[model samples]
Every structure is written in C-alpha cells, then in structure tokens.
Target: MDLNVKITVLGAGAIGSLWAVALKQQQHDVQVWTRSSDSEYSVNYQDLNGNTHPLLFTANSVEHLSQSDLLLVTVKSFQVEVALAPIIKLIPNSCLIVIMHNGIGSHEAVKALFSNHCVFYATTSQAALKADAKLQHTGNGQTFIGSLFSANSSYNVLTEVFNQALSPCYWQDDIMEPLWKKLAINCAINPLTAIYQCTNGELANKNYQAQLIQVCNEVTLVMRAEGYRVKNDELYQQALTVINATADNYSSMNRDVFYQRPTEIDYITGYLIHRAKKFDIAVPVNTQLWQTIISMESSYHA
Candidate 1:
C-alpha cells in the first residue's frame, strides 16, 4: 500500500537539498528547515547523463515548523543537537525522525534525550555539491536506511516511501555492518582529504597510500572489536573503490576546513579514537589523524 506522508528535511546543505528535492519529486509533501532564512533555496539536478534541471522548494525557519509525518535530520554530524533542539520539541512523539548524515553519534545524541519518537539512521553516497546559491547534483547514489536501536512502526512506511519514490534504498535488520563499513571509508577518506587539501582520488597517489592504509587498518580493527566482519585489506580496496567512484569530489571535512567552518572530525576520527580506547587497543594512527585535524581546525579558526 502507498502511504502519503509529510516529511520535513532539516538541513539545507547539498545532501539535504538533494533529498528534499528528490523526495518532493516523488509526490510527497516535503518542506525544508534551515537555520535561517535564505532566498537561495535552489538546486540543479544533474542526471546521470549530465542533463541539468533546476529545482526550487519551500524553505522555512525553525519557528515556522509545523507538524510533519516524518522529519529527516540532514545536518552535519556535529550540528544535530542545535539544529533539532527547538524543532524536536515542536515535533510530536508520533512523528518519525530519520537522520541522514555522515559519521555517527547523532542518533546516540537524540537517543540520550530519551524521546519517544521513532528514530532511524541513514547513510547515503548520493553526492551533491553546493555552489553560490544553488547546489549541483553531481552523482546519483543509493540511500541506505538502518534502525538507530530497533525498527518501529514507521519502518515499513519509511521503507515503502524510499523504495517507491526516492532512490534505491534498503532496510537492514542490523545496519551496523554497512554503517561501520561506510564509517571505515569515511575515516580513511574525509579527514585525510581535509589535511591534504585534495580531492578524494588524490589519496590514490603513492605518496598518501600508506596513510590511507594505516587509517584503514585502524578502523578495521575497531570495527572487528565491535563484532563486525572487517578485513583491513578488503576495506582498503573498498576505500579505493569509493575514491575512484567519487574521485573529483571534495569531502565534507575538506569543505568545512576550506570554508573555515567546524568540521565533523570529532564524530568521525574522534569517535574512532574513543572506540579504540574501549578495547584498550592502540590506534596511534587514528589518534594522530584526529590530533592533526583538530590542530588544523584551531589554527584555521583562530
């Protein structure tokens, strides 16, 4: 059965804009919630063949938040708390909140509040690049949906919405595998890109290959510690696959650093460092990566 739902996407970055437009195209009532008022709520949808289509949508402030059947939290990993603080209160427990962003811990932050609203975690390779006033859809990637803790009544409706309207998506009984795997790749790619000031594929250069491998190895060990099936070599190769696939794109961290904004280093590399400490495992490489990124942030922000 097809279910009609009102969805509010709470973020106006590249990915948020992409999902907002994509879901709206599917005939769902989708509204966007950004931090402030922006008249430049436009996006260029570039199809696989390089065809571009302009999409404009309704954008509202946090104060204007009305009831929606679902809320898609698409802010940066670190911005989740502030972004949803006021808006979450406006949302009812009956509303389902789905978080789609890079890295981890956002869901846990919400779970810490002990809210009764259904919460789910999502990861997507869907690539969108933000320009002056409009975001460009650079790539079409699949969206992966997973439960934050347990699947709830909204799972079927959310799954059906994506499966029927949005891009290719799946519901996982245990999303930790794919989530961790994606995390492994992000830890290897995003921070390094920020430090090196290069595109994803630049890491493929022989000079940076060792650093990439070390990061991969450290992440794999942590993933294994958490009981996920992970092989360092296999993850290394998989990371390469992601790099080749999105070779020209700058990582979110790279953008954050370049723009002198706060990066999600704490959630990505910082989270990995915390996990390593739990197992009393030495992740000197991850530690150094985290410190390097943090130091760069301080110097740049200062």
Candidate 2:
C-alpha cells in the first residue's frame, strides 16, 4: 500500500522516535517535534534479531507541525499540556491524533482539550528508551488501537497505517478496557519496581510477591467500581505473566527514578486513588504507592 500521509510525532522520546523511524522506513513522510531546539534527533532502530542502525532526522517546531496528516503523541503525561499549548493552533482540526501513552485518563484529557479533532487511544507493549539522541528498541510487543466511541472509517485508515508501518494493530470496539488493563499492569509493577529499585524479575521473589498482589487488588477494585470489568485475580495473573516475560527489563518509571526524572505515578496509581474516592472504593495499597513515589520525588529534589 502506498502511504501518502505526512506524520508528525510529538515529544521525540523513546516511543515517539521509534514510531517516527518505523514510519519513515515504510516510505511515509515523517517528522518529529522536540522541545530541544537542537538541529537533529538521533534514532537507532533495533530489530528482533538484535541488529541496530542509527539515523538522524531534523526536529521541527510546534508551529510547523500543523500540516501533518496524523500526529502521534508520546510525551510524558505531565508534559502533554505544556508541550501542546503553543502548537495547538497549528494542529488541523481534521488531523488524527493518536496518543500511545502508558497511563489512564490520557484519552479523556486529550479529548477535552482538543474537542475539534479526532482523538484515539493506543496501547503497546513495545519497550524502548532514548540514549545519546537515539531510541533503543528493547522489547517487541503488539499495539492495540480503538476510537473513544465505535469504529469509524478513520479507524480503517489508522489500522492500515499502523499495520503497514508498526504492525500487529488490534482493533477493538471499546479501547478503554485495554487502556485500563494496561494501567492495571502499570500500577501493579511500575511503582513497586521504582520504589524498591528492582527490575521486573525482582518482583517474583517471595518478599515482593504479596505486595505485588496487593497492588493489583487495589487497581482491580478501583477499575471495577468505575464500571470496568476487571477482576483482581485476573489482573494479578497478568502482572505475574508480565513480570516473568520482561524479567530483566526495567520499567519506564524505574528508569525515571534512577535518573532522578519525574515519574508518571500521578497518572498511574495516583489516578486510581483519585477515582477510587469518587466511587467510595478504598485503594490503600495504591495510595501508599502514590505517596511513596511522591516522597521519592521530594528526596530526589532534596
């Protein structure tokens, strides 16, 4: 299929760079927007066979991004608003905005802010990190996408673009389920790993297994009370499976804590705690994890 779409990736972080490089390789017109006024963003592509190649692309400013046919947002949750504010006027109302973020509430937040455009939520297990201006693709995983409502013709174009450029796009009637499911996994593993300074494998030890279950339980309760059909047992099993599969991998939150960068705990566990209060559901475990991450941030600054 011939891809005539002009794609712009905001943030130019690990995931953003990964998508930009992948799309560019597929023969699409791809550009990346970065906060860094630097002339170029470096990206390294690594396949499943362990081969790597480095490439550099020019970084465009927000005002120049308005002409893109599609915009993939990969900014940290906290930076979303600030990063897009100056460029909001540049985004065409007809352009599709795909937010491939890791936490809950991003879709709603983006939808509220960009009411005129089509906002879609996407989730992927593809692991990546930035190093020396290049994005390192660490692990391979599939991506799921769906509209906030039912399927539209636009989604057909999106699925085609994703399948050709990124691959393994699962279309769903309701994307919220997978969004919250991924959020449950993040709430269970990210904070614990960040706080304990351990990899996913370390959670398998007896000392951390029970705490892991508790975190999953807290997220499950909040999700269920919020009208999502997530069970504690199922979420716990999913967390365990992820821990075993990515045993040596350090989560993004873990990397943030290690680098003294701000973590996305507020959008992950903290979002659960905030919603639990609205539903009169108790989420002490998640609340504690939220507090712990906040304390870590305080200490990092201190």
Candidate 3:
C-alpha cells in the first residue's frame, strides 16, 4: 500500500518499544521520545518466539515531532497528560493521534487537550515488557481501534499501517464495547492476582471463583448504568475465558505491584467506580479492590 509516514512513539516503555520496532520494520520513519534525557537510539527486541533482533530508530529530536504525521501514545494511563503536555505543541495539529493503553479515561483527557486533532483510542491485547534496553514480546493479540472525537478522519491509512506492522488490527465503528470488555477482564483478574501474588490461572480456582463473580457483577452494574448493554453472567464468563487463556502469565497490574511500581488500578477499576457513583450505583467490591491497590501503592516506599 506504500504506507510511509513519520511516526513518533511518545513513550519508550514495553508497549511503546514493541510498536516502535514493529512500525520500523514496516519501513516507516519511527522515532521515540522518553522521559530520560539519555536514552538509546536502538531497542533490542525479542519476538514472541524468542528470536532476538536489534532494531534501530530515528534520532529522538524535537524537529522530528513537528514533522510527524502520526503520534502513537503507549504511556501508562495515569501519565498520559504529563507525558504529552510538553510535546503537544511541537506536533502538527493535523497529525493523527492514537492513544493505546491498558485502561480508559485517558482518551477523554487527550481529546479535550488536543481539541484540534483527531484523537483515537486503541485497546490491544498484545503484551510486552521491558528489561533494561531489551523489549520482550510476551504474547500476541489483536488490536481494536476507533475514533474517540473525530469521526471523519481517514482510517484506511492507519488500518493498513497498523495491520501490516501488527496483524489482526480491526477497525470498529463502536470501540467502546471492546474497550469496556477489556476493562471488565482487567477488573476481574488484575487486582485479585496482584493481591494474592498468583498467576492468571489461579483466579479460576474454587477459592477465588466467588470473588471473581462479585467483581464482574459490580463492573456489569456500572457498565449497564453507563449505557453499555453488558450482562453480569457474560462478563463473568469472559473473565473466566481470559483466565484460562493466559493461565501462566501474570497480568500487568500483578507485575507492577510485585515490582513496587505504580499500577493503573485508577484507570481500570477507578474509572468504573467513578461512573458508578455518577449513576448512584453501588460497586462496593470494585471500590474495595481499588482502595486496596491504592493502599498497596502507598506501602511501596514504606
């Protein structure tokens, strides 16, 4: 399709590095921006099958951002605003912006901040983690994208570029359903796994089955109140399916809490709790999990 554009990845973390390498392999002009003043120009990428390759990126310069046609943001949900505030003016107004992160809420903030640009939301199941200068592709999953603010933008170019770089990228007319579903899965599995220091599979055990169902029920109530047609049973079953699918791997929240790093519990469960309060809905279970994670985060330094 001869798709070539100047793409700038706003974060050099695991997810950011994964896509940076994938897009560069597709021959796009890819550069990365990191929080550190001293960062590498290349990333050591390890594919899903454990094949390691040295991938190079363009110079991380302010001028490159001005010429960027697309900005793919892969930062944590909480750091979205802080990371983009500095470089937001450097990027062209006409550039297509895609914020692909774990949880919700960041899309609204970005849409409001970048009012002139077409902001899109992407939810991906593809997992990766960073170790020093190396990025490991832990799992392969599809990507779903849809427009959050601008509905008239050209998605064909984005679909082709993303699909070729990372296969199975689907364009959805209503991306919120899939995004909420992903959040449902995260809400049900992530906190329990983190608290218990267990893998995803352990959530399927009898000991945790009731707790999992309660979490899903609370999330389903909030979802329906927020205008989504989600059922409690269906959400519970979906969580079970995910628990079986990624049985061995620990969730991102689990890893974050284990490493004493800040987790995105705020965006995942916190977003739901906020909506629940808006509708006068009771989400006690979700609230407890959110508070527990917040408590855990507080004890990170103690």
Candidate 4:
C-alpha cells in the first residue's frame, strides 16, 4: 500500500496501461512491460474531473523487470502462457503475481508454472482501450480481489493494495462466484453484440431480446448443472443492465473481430462448452455462439 512499493505491470495493453497510470498517479513506483522494445509508451486517461490526460511512461523490457514487489499480469487470456514464460525466472519468490483476465483457468496455469509463489485473481468491470499510444478509460466499475479459496491472508493484503491503487476494491470469500458471474455476462452479451455489430441497447429489439433470453437460459442451466447457483432471470437482468449502461461503446470482442484479430471466445463461451462436455450437459445456445464466432473469424481471415 506504500508509494515506495515497486509494481511491474506485464502486458501493457488497454487494461494494463490504465492500471499503470492509476498506480503512477498515486505515486507508486510503477513500470510497464510490453511485447515491444519501444522506449516510450503513451496512454490516454481521464481523471475524476473528466479531463483527459495522456501519459507517456518509460518502457522496459523483460530483462529490466526483476526489481518489482508485485507483478500484475494483464495480458489477454490466450497470451498468458507465452507472456509469462520469458519473465518467470526473473521474478523473485517473495513477489505476488496478480492475474486480471477474463474467463477461467489462468490462475491454475500460473500456479503450475510458479509453484512456490503467491498468485492472486482479480476481476473488474472497468473498460479501457489504447488510442495511438494513449490509454483511455472509457467506463468506471468496481474491481474484486481475492485468492482462489476462502480464509486466506493473501486476500486481505492484496485487497488493501488494490484499494490504495484503485477505487472500490472488494474482498470476496469465494472469488469464483464473481468470476463465473462476469464470465456468464460476457458469454451472453459479448458474442451476440459483436456478431450483430450493435450496441448493448440494440439487444432490446424484440427479435434480439428473444435470442438473448435463450442464450441466458442455456447458460443458466449449464451453471446449475455445474453446482453453481444462478437464477436465469436475475442473470438476464444483469446482462441487460450492463448493456444499457455501456450501450454506446463497442464491446472488446467486436473490436477484435472487426480488426481480423483472434477473439477470446475459447475462454468465455468455449470454456463453458468444454466443461459441459466433461459433465455430459447440453449447452446448445453457447455451442452455437462459439461455432458462429469461430466461423466469423475464419471468414474474416479468408
């Protein structure tokens, strides 16, 4: 929680850049590691007063990332393994590795690689992006921090650190609940909105509304079969509320698909489809969405 604490942010993409700026604003010794070897990194950020601040920070390579108290991994879920491979040996055993990614399985992957170190999981509703080297914070939301299990001391310490660095740091007893909750939201809203190239509000149309409800219903059944308690109507309402709140902005999945880049479908809806197969459960709606997105990606490339 001290400003003297050295923090190294891995994967200086949109989310990572916003965090680096916020920590720097609080006077924390923060440095960002990116895939590129560029010396200067620029990010566009807006303060509480709605003033845009473009920050340019000195960039460092993986070789220069050894001197940090905490390492925040903000890479896309698919790139987590590759990004961490180069820097894992340089990280000291005392430092904590915080992973902020969508979907599941990231923590297990990191834990398997670094068996002796502390790894934490964090989820946030905060939305951000990079515009010509400027990291822009598009929307504000709360962030939850904790370990995989309950009654862990590391959860409290990490919660305090996040609270000092960002606003509304919530500590939960079971982090998986919120993680799955957010994943469910992404499963329903992301692919549908991306495929149609429409804002969240556009889902309110009668035709799209019926399709949205069906998707949520199928996902609800999958979650319940997995022994997770989630009401279909409640989750559907939450998804609709989020769509309305950020109705004007483009969902991240849409950006990826539009730019001919690989999306995180394998992590979001695909993760569920994988689990459903393991349990012999039916998830037709999710399966359809997953296949549709994959086909879209294939068509975009072809």
Candidate 5:
C-alpha cells in the first residue's frame, strides 16, 4: 500500500501485458520492458469480462537502464537468459525482483543474476494468450508469490499490492508446495496435449485417458520419491480436475507445437525426468513423452 510505487514489468507478452494493465488500473507508476527494444510499447488486452484495454506502457529496452521499486520478470521461460543477460550486471542491488513465468529453474537463474537484491519465485494459474501486441485473457486464476524458502516484510507488502489489484494473490511461506504441484500437473498433461495437438478436453476421451493415467502415475511416483508424500490416487484425481476445469483450453505446449514455435517441454516433463533421476526412479511414461515432444520441436525448424 505504498503510494506511487514504481513498478517495472519485464517482457511484454500476454502475462506481462495483463499485469501491466492490472497495476495501471490500481493507479501505480508502471513501466514495461522488452529485450528487443528500449522504449515505450503499446499493450492491448481483453479481460475475462470482455473488457478491452489499450495503453502505452512506459518501457525500457535494457533492464539496468531504468530503476524501479519493483521489477517483475514476466518473460517466457526460455527467453529468460537472453533478456536479462545484458542488464544483469547492471541491476541495482536494492531493487526487488520477482521471477514470474512458466516451468521451473528460471528462478534459480534469475536469483543468481540478482544475488544481492530482494528476489522471489512466483507462479500464477491465470491463463492469457498473446499475438503481436494483442492479448486475450482466457481464464482468471490465483497467483501465489513466494521466496525460495520463506517470505519477509517486503513479501507481505508486494502480496498486499497484488491482492489489492484485480486478481487474488497470496504469499506462500513454502513455495515448493505450489511449485511441485504445478510441475506435477504440467508433467501429466502438457506433453501429451502437445504431441496429440488437442485441447485439454480431448484427453478425457478413451483414446488418451489411459495415457493420461500413465503419465500421472509416473509423476506421482517421482514426486513421492522426491519427498513430497503425495499419493498416486490423489495426484491422478487432481489432474483430472484440472483437465475438466480447463477442458476447452489448449495448453501452452499445445499452442506452441501447433504454431511451430519452440515448446517448454524440457522444463515441464523434462524437469520431472531430471528429478526422477536423482531418486533412481523409473519414469518410462514421462521419459517417452519428453523425447516425443523434443522430436516435435525439432520438426518445427527442420
């Protein structure tokens, strides 16, 4: 609730545009940053309520070229490095940075870049899509912000700001809980959707149901072995609920494959495979799905 809190949102993608409008609605000093250029950019978005918002976001091409109280890293998972590398060394030691993106591992990378600053890993289920400068708000979901381990006073302040905005934002004392849960869900659903080029609802049919179960089972085993204490039956059921809830929606991976763009297969199922290796767990289903998506991505450029 600090008045006139300067907020710089990194990346001008779907989620980035969504947050820019949300923060702007709350009347905060806002700016958007993109690696391609270092100037103001126009962001247009349509919300879940069918409200279209268009605004010129004060933008910075270089991360270190501008200073803000809060720096939100909202770039695509794969583009994190290329976007932040030029300015990582220039980041102010006192700036608070939040890494908000799909998949895992990006947080560790960003934290390393801002080793001396206030850094946190955050995840949001709020789904949005972007094409050029246009953004479509697909679904409204909760966004949880958390530190690598525990939250502090600054966490509370940022959580309050997000809560006061349009979406429900919570501070997580143990971020690993949500992080693992999302990873498990993505492992079970994302790759298959990409390979099949189908919507979430399509996975419920007989053709894909068994495969879904197999992926979920493997993910459950890996998660339990990783010390999560999650049960296979419970995990499978939760995944089914997610599929049904987002039935008509095409997953990010699915869209990536359909559009011939690079997918985050490595971070989703690949992350599970990486963790399973540590436990010496056999995740055959996940492994196959991972390799399959990798093949799919290769076909794009070939």
Candidate 6:
C-alpha cells in the first residue's frame, strides 16, 4: 500500500471533514460520500492556527468508491449500519475500513458485514465541532487505531499516512482497552451533561460528584466483567480530567439533546447496560441515565 491512497469519507460531519481536509492536504485522493448530496461539497474548516479556509471535495460515487483505498466511517454510532449497508457492495474489498465514532457495539455488526476485509476500530481525542457552517479544530489529541478482524494486518503504511495527516497517530495491538476507556469517559460525561443541561465543567462541581462516581463505578464494573483492566477511581479521575480540561464545552450528547437531533446514547450508555445484563451486573446509575435520555429522545422524536 502506498502513502498516497484514494480515500472516501463516509460522513462529512466535523471529524469526517477534518480528516478529509487533512488527507487532502497530505495529497491523498480524498472525496466525501454523503447522504444528502452526490455533487461536489466544500467544508468550511478552521485549522489549529486559526486559519479559516474552504476545503472542497468531490462526490464519492460508486465508481470512485471501487477505486478507493480507504473508507473512513465517521457517522454517529446508530447511523453506521444504515449508512454502510447501502454501499457495502460498492466498496472494494481492497479498501481499508476504519470505523471511528463516539460509542461502541456498531463495530460488531460492521465486523460481521465485512468479515473478509480488514476492519479497524480507532479512538481519537482530537476534538472538532461545527459552528455556523464552519468546522473548528479545538483539540489536537492523539489517535489510537487497531485491527478488529485482521490481527496480522500490517499497519506501518496506514500509520504513516495518518501521522502525516495528523501527528501522534499510533497503532495498538489491543484497541479494546482504549475503546473501553474512552467509553468510560464518555459514559461519565456526555449523558450527565445532557441530563443536567450544563457545560462539562459543571459536572466537576460537588453537586454532581456522587452521580459521576456512581456512573464511573457502574461502568468500571461492566468493564471488569468484560475482562478489561480498569478501576472505578481511575475512570472517575479520567472523566474529571476531561471535564476540567474542556470546562467550557458542551458534550456531543448535550448538543444532540438540545438540538433534538439523534444521539449516540444507544451506543454509549445503552451498550454498557446491554453488556451489564450479559454479565448479570447491575448498573442502576447507567440504567437511569439511559432511560432518562431515551425518554427525552422519544418525547422529541415522537
């Protein structure tokens, strides 16, 4: 595989747009395959240096997808199956598949669907948000990626490609640990932020401490039951670190609920609750948060 690979971003939201621009800047053949349009699209991006520019991308049609060397899926967790199902056959087996999203469990379906292909799961702390039609690059955090199906897959070429586009991207032998850890952080922050309708920093207040502790403890229990090495206090501390670091920001779930758009709750807390049931572990705190979010979504979606 070469460094300059033809890539198609499956979703053109903030993260997808960020990668599309980064890959294009690295001189990769990048196109965006979007649900809304088949025409050329442009992303209004604000780079880390406070530079604002328009990054244009061609529409990734079926023919373009067949020649694509990579398909980067950045849709919301619940949208993954639907978005990929329609184009699975169009994407060539030679194209690498990278699923990067907020929550987990969607990869299971993707693994089954693309069983023969090399599927990878990645977690990134790099933060980007859309504001008034422009994508803002906030945090330049490290990205960890690993193989989901092809354990013997060589990632040197892919790693280099990503590093050129975005520094500090590493390939991990076991991606699940980071995935679970990120899940713990999200479980502690996202839903609670939405439930309380507050910024991430507010969660650091003493009033929210008990809720945070219980959420982390529940998630830690499920994580341990699933055989991941984690501790309740560690998870809680990680969440607090993120909250304090991103004190002024509202979580993705908080924005989703505020805007009445679909959220990845089904994949975040919902996934945790499902696994807890499998292990017969009770996650009352998570269950409550999940139910509250579900109720809110239903009320608006109904």
Mind giving the per-residue lDDT tens digits that candidate 2 earns over 1-302? 13678888888778888888888888777888888777667777776567887876767755447678898888988788777777888999878888888787665557678888877878888877777665677777888888884465446778788877777778767888888889999998999999999999889999997888888888878788868887549999999989998998899999999999998998888878878889888888888889999999989968
TM-score per candidate: 0.93, 0.94, 0.95, 0.94, 0.93, 0.96
CA error at residue 295 for candidate 4, angstroms: 0.9
Clashing pairs in 2: none
Residue-wise C-alpha lDDT for candidate 6, range 9-89, written one tens digit per residue? 999888888888889999999999988765787878888899998877898577789899988999999999899998998
Q: CA lDDT of 284 in candidate 5?
A: 92
Per-candidate RMSD, Å? 2.1, 1.9, 1.7, 1.8, 2.0, 1.4
Residue range with the least summed lDDT across 10 consecutive positions in model 3: 148-157
Q: Per-residue lDDT tens digits of candidate 5, residues 1-302? A: 36567788888877888888888888988888776564777867788888888888777744433557788888878888778887776566666788887778776676667668778778888878888888888888888888884456456888887777656998988777788888877887788888888888787788787887888888888777877888758777888888888899899889989999888877788888888899998989889988988988888877
- Clash pairs, candidate 4, are 42-133, 43-134, 43-135, 44-134, 44-135
Q: Write the per-residue lDDT of candidate 3 for residues 146-231, one digit (tens) a residue.
A: 88765644686787788999988988777887899899999999999999999999898999988899999988888887788875
Q: Which residue pairs show backbone clashes in model 1?
A: none
lDDT of 4 by residue, 1-302 (tens): 34466888888877898889988887877788888888767776775457888777767755446767889999989889999997789898877888898888666677788787777788998887676666667788889877773357644766776777678889876777788888888988889988998876787677888778888887787778878888659778988888888887777788888787888999899988887788888888889999999999999847
Local distance difference test, each candidate = 0.80, 0.82, 0.87, 0.81, 0.80, 0.88
- Which numbered prediction scores highest in TM-score against the true structure? 6
lDDT (C-alpha) at residue 240 in model 6: 93
Which is better, 1 or 2, measured by lDDT?
A: 2
Worst 10 residues of 4 by lDDT: 149-158
Cα error, residue 162 of model 5, in Å, equals 1.7
lDDT of 3 at 99: 91
- Of 2 and 3, the candidate ahead on TM-score is 3
